[model samples]
Target: MADRLTGQPFTTRSEIIAQHGMAATSQPLATQVAIDILKQGGNAIDAAIAANALLGLVEPTGSGIGGDLFAIIWDAQSQQLFGLNGSGRSPISLPLNYFSQQKLTAIPAFGPLSVSTPGTVDAWYEMHQKFGSLSMATLFQPTIDYAEQGFPMTETISIEMALSAKHLQGFPNFAQTYMPNGMTPTKGTLFKNPHLANTLKHIAKYGRNGFYKGDIAKTISRYMKDNGGFLNEEDLSQHKSEWVTPISTHYRGFDVWELPPNGQGIAVLQILNMLEQHDISRMGFGSEALIHTVIETIKLVYEDRAKFYCDPDFNHIPIKTLLSKDYAQKRNALIHYKANLQVGSGMSGSHHIGQNLSALNHGDTVYLTTADKQGNMVSLIQSNYRGMGSGMTPTNLGFVLQNRGQLFSLHPQDHNVYQPNKRPFNTIIPAFVTQNDKPWLSFGVMGGPVQPQMQVQILMNLIDFKMNLQEAGDAPRFLHAGTSQPTGKKMTQGGYISLESGFSASVMQGLIDRGHDIQDLSGEFGGYQAIAWNDKKQVYFGASESRKDGQASGY
Candidate 1:
């Protein structure tokens, strides 16, 4: 009954191929919205921004204007990749001493205390200012109309919405905005937020000032003051997205790229650098050797991540040393046929590393990639952090403030420790790949720590196993969670493994024999989206994860 010729068993469909333009995103509506923008003569970056705005309205569980954004853009004209870090900082008024006086060991996951200045709007403005050809009004109008006219909630978003309502409903203005009539929305339910429509109108008209300096900024500041939150108008106004050079590591023949510190993107490069030593193709996909090697490699790099990964502006990160081939070789030497019970970071740290690994694995985020006929491609990831954010919904603003500050450590000496005007350690990242100095792939996986792990697997599937774009994403993914986190928690007892459903029983037994703690976990593998350039065919191949309510379409 199914066409099995071009697809793996797990692949729900073949990759979408198009010569003109392509877009892949977590929601079908959002994907279509991007295609619409491209059809309207917008570039890949413009379509990405428009689709992201629509996602904030349609899939608030994973993304919103309240979140932070990171992107890797492949500019066909320059033949160079660009990275944008649009993350925000903590309020200058709240110093580390405040947390000390409060005697809080970690920032709370939800509430005004965890709130940070939102950077999504500024990110949109920055991106549009640099590369956009269309007016802000043109890019945002579709989402504004959708927000007012309403869109049907997909099943995935519906489930997440119900879960979010349980924790967020009690917060100020959350119920009035999300849970209308005091009820959680179900699948196929049409939802509208006229307030969000108004907000989008302001953004479309006034660009960045509409959000960070005007009535919107005042409302946010007033809301924080009343709710005991630290974020204020000044914090919002001072927020800016920085354009940074993307860092890369050569794996097998292709160059894999990710953003530097402040975000955990480079961890993908670090992990790939370690795995480069192994001849994984011979081991085969889903084999004991390959899975074990990948899992172990992930553990090795994540150790370095916890100790070294942070905002480079605040602390000097040993990027050159960590990504050095010599360093990877030394780390790879520590891996063997059996799981290493005692794993430590490559670097020495004052705080204990890998001592008490946190079991928290899930994160709420959305990833999308778009390719234009001009050969430009954009890989973008956005998140509200911990799902639906801090629950600090400003009145009539129609979006919650991000709780990203929760990732900051209370340890004063830690690189990611809470500080005035410093950004919290961000988990969201965007990734890209190039071959022979040409844009090869624009892709990303969205989950907490799962982002880097899944990203590494995707590259391996493509380069090592030669799987097609769709098959590469649909392949069974293993999540090796509980590595030391930026929040100052360490992994203990070698951490554990959560295998996806597609792995064989023998492979499961193989991991168990190797001293791995194989356990069943609710699927947290991650949602993926990608667009690859076919230099020969002169077309684009797009793929979206089957596990998500997403679509990959082309014109």
Candidate 2:
């Protein structure tokens, strides 16, 4: 019997596996844009920008110009690593007293009050200014064309839009802009956003100011002010993305690097550190032992993240102490060979040390990985907190604003307290692994609070289990959702671990035996994309998540 969905003949694995220059992503058009840029002799940065711009057009609900950006770039020539902190700060008008006066317990859900100044466009410009050969205008042309002329609605985009449509219906501008005719466009239907096209055009012509200080900013601020929102002209004018040095640790013979603070990259490094002592290969891939070790390591790292990780500017993140070999050894010592340890019981060393760590808020983000012909590589991640970002589409800008402000803790005593002009805690971490001094792979995953867990699994698959980039990304995964205490009493239900379909039944039973409440997921836990540099082949190979409706293509 024929498969009713895909009418055409399905290609065999032998044929599909023979394809070259792989590029994996969450959307088809974004992958094509990267392939086009690579074909045109552009490097990784250029290709990444091209792809990222197109993602804003096609996958508007996930990411766009109105968001923060972060990246870990590996320069092959100088053998130096660079980090871009494209996160935006809170509005100066957002005083702590404002929330107090309004008697608000937490930040608003989706509105102007929840919005933050977007830093993605300027971040792209800054990255191009420092490393790209192609003009910024050229990088944006593909995206502008897609936005103005229209592009086909993809299965992933359509589904995500429809599922989240309820949150989007309240904002008339967003509805009119994205759903125009009072209906979500079906897959393969042509979708265009003229307002976004004009916005991109202004950026191409006038540079980054096209959105920050000019007409676009004015329109956004005006809309927010009139709508009982906190974002103002001052927020737009004050927004600036920074460049920071990346934090790294050596595992086996490879060096893994990730951005500091704001991002949860340090947590990923910590997980690797905890698992470093175990010969996971000896446990055999996907064995109960291997899964247990991996899950235990994730719990240790995430426990620290919940306790201590936040914006470094606002809180003292002991990055060096956390990633140090001594800390890893101490945490690794808690792993028992026979069974899974309870969450609170897993804490080693002084209990006072654990008190310093506090749980922070998470945000929605996108991740992109690229490797150019010249060996330059980029692991990029960006976000607007959630789908359609606060659900506020200011009159002519054509982009939804990010709700980063919601990441702030409403409590004044909290380390991540909502403060004027302070950045929020973000989960958008990108990672790179290097052999010797050369970049070996660029990878990242998109999930609100699942990033650290997903990253650790990918690293384990590649570093510990010896799998390739595609296999590592395609492998089944699990996440131990961290817990939050409202009144110093730990909430155990939040500690429930989620497992994907491919995990072994033995592993599931083992987790259950250890007192973990287990939940099953239908393989859509997280979306991951990765690129590996093959020194022998002298070409880049990319892999996109099979669970997602996107592909990876390279030229």
Candidate 3:
């Protein structure tokens, strides 16, 4: 019954997994947890929060309650998407002169100074208060159980644990908790964190006060005091998440949406607009021409991003001008074939306008997308900035705080310069797309600068190449790195575009012949998870990237 050459029968067929309601996440258990919540009468928002909590437990390297959260919720009842910026601000006590006094050229990556007040907890409470149908207690119990009772660790997490163990060895109890045996465990190992369980249990029962005002707050403040961190009880108590409107740009008859600045979601829209001028479908995937165009287009977009994107509260952001078709056209005029050009920011017409940006932008992160039977959908992403975060574990609280401060620039006039109680430009953004005022796709790819690039590729794969969700995610991707740093870092010589393994040798040479710098690499492409609704069929299709250990299913 099997075709020996292609192994047809035995091989898994990558199809759009269809169901009445669907869930897709970077962890199989998280996806199952979400579906369970939906089946129990919870809406997409409820399932999303539940799934995110579980993901923190199952994939601690990529995320945890100690990090930040950004979400885009598709509320079927209201028929509108909601954006929440759950990112925290830098310490108020740390003024602009702090870095100067410390003789620091760049912000430190680890310890107290790097930690922003944890925002995921506040985000969870905000979203739940607005949309959750299930009790918070009910939603958190499963993850608390998993954290309390040891669960089998996945291979990828094990590898990450071993890699990050050295940086974490110095943090209090990090070694004792994560590496009980004084060394990171291998795959198939059982790991547990009763400390995290207690933390979640307290939050579930007492809500925001449990984490922000009580023992949790005390623990964080004490750790900062003892370790030269500026965070205090005041900072914890003052923490709040903002609800904002989502922005959009039209592409090929569909409206792609993303959260505005302090997020690079604007850059994603800019990239789509720049590439829209080219006939991508005709050029095709893996073509040197397509790759060259995208790389150049992204370079131009990021150039504007570095100089303008920042926290709007701290800077004047010309959101409208940056996303204007005129701006995209102006940037698109810079692309030159056969020569890798170093690009920077462009003015929005005759006037200089502010752009959107985020910090702690690069990180190991997790994305979850959910859709319920009622047509409600959610695209949510959370991150700790870097793998294992800032390596600063508070006394016995059992989670790493994000190194978001690293994104703050020391340049006095920079839009993203260090500021008291100001949120950094955030990189972990969730995205959704709608067509004709109806929900289309809810998806996100997790990585630092790679997120926006991967997202564009996914859309192009689906729209231009006509690939199914699974195929789009599985297809080989091109990653351009060291391109443009919005934080004011000087542009390096020339950034290289890395190609995944599946590209033919001729394609590789073809890119080089076009004066593009190419590299053979593995593992920088983002982990993608998405759910698309087909209104005509009245079914939902889910997809999970083959690059990650994840699952996508519907019911």
For residue 406, give model 2's deviation from the true position in Å: 1.5
Report the candidate with higher TM-score, 1 versus 3.
1
User: Where is the poorest 10-residue window by lDDT in model 1?
Assistant: 351-360
Which segments of candidate 2 are over 4 A away from where they belong? 1-23, 337-364, 485-494
Runs with alpha carbons beyond 4 Å of true place in candidate 3: 1-12, 348-362
Which model is ahead, 1 or 3, in terms of lDDT? 1
lDDT of 3 by residue, 4-104 (tens): 34222222346556566899998888999999999999988899999999988888888888899999998998899999999988887878788788997
Error of 1 at 443 (Å): 0.4
Q: Comparing candidate 2 with candidate 3, which one achieves the higher lDDT?
A: 3
Supply the TM-score for candidate 2.
0.90
Q: How well does candidate 1 score on lDDT at residue 56?
A: 96
What is the C-alpha lDDT profile of model 2 across 1-555, one tens digit per residue?
342232212211110121234455678878788877877778878888888888887887678888888988988788888999999888887788887798976777577777878889889988998899888778889988888889889886787777656786787488888886887788999999888888888888988888788888898889888877778778887877899998889888889888888767888888888778888778866667777777777766766765566677777767878989998998888777544445542333322211111222233456787776667888888778776688888997778888877766676555566788888777788888888777788889887667877887888777777766667777677776544321112334325677776666887887777666776444336788888877766777677777666677666
> 1-555, model 1: which lDDT tens digit per residue?
353786455645678999999999999999998999999999999999999999999999989999999999988888898899999999999988888788877788889889888889999888888888888888889889988999999998899889888888999999999998887678998999899999989877887999999999999999999989878888988899999999999998899899998988878888888788888899988899998999898888887777777888899899999889999999989899898776778887675432453534657999999999999999999999888899999999888888888888888777788888998889999999999999899999888767899998999999998989999999889988667887888786788899988788999998999999987766588889999999998999999988789999999
Per-prediction TM-score, please?
0.98, 0.90, 0.95
Residue 160 lDDT, candidate 3, scale 0-100? 74
- Residue pairs that clash (backbone atoms under 3 angstroms), model 3: 306-486, 309-356, 309-357, 310-357, 358-425, 358-426, 359-425
Model 3 lDDT vs. the true structure? 0.82
| True lDDT of residue 24, candidate 3 | 93
Ranking by lDDT: 1, 3, 2
Error of 3 at 405 (Å): 1.5
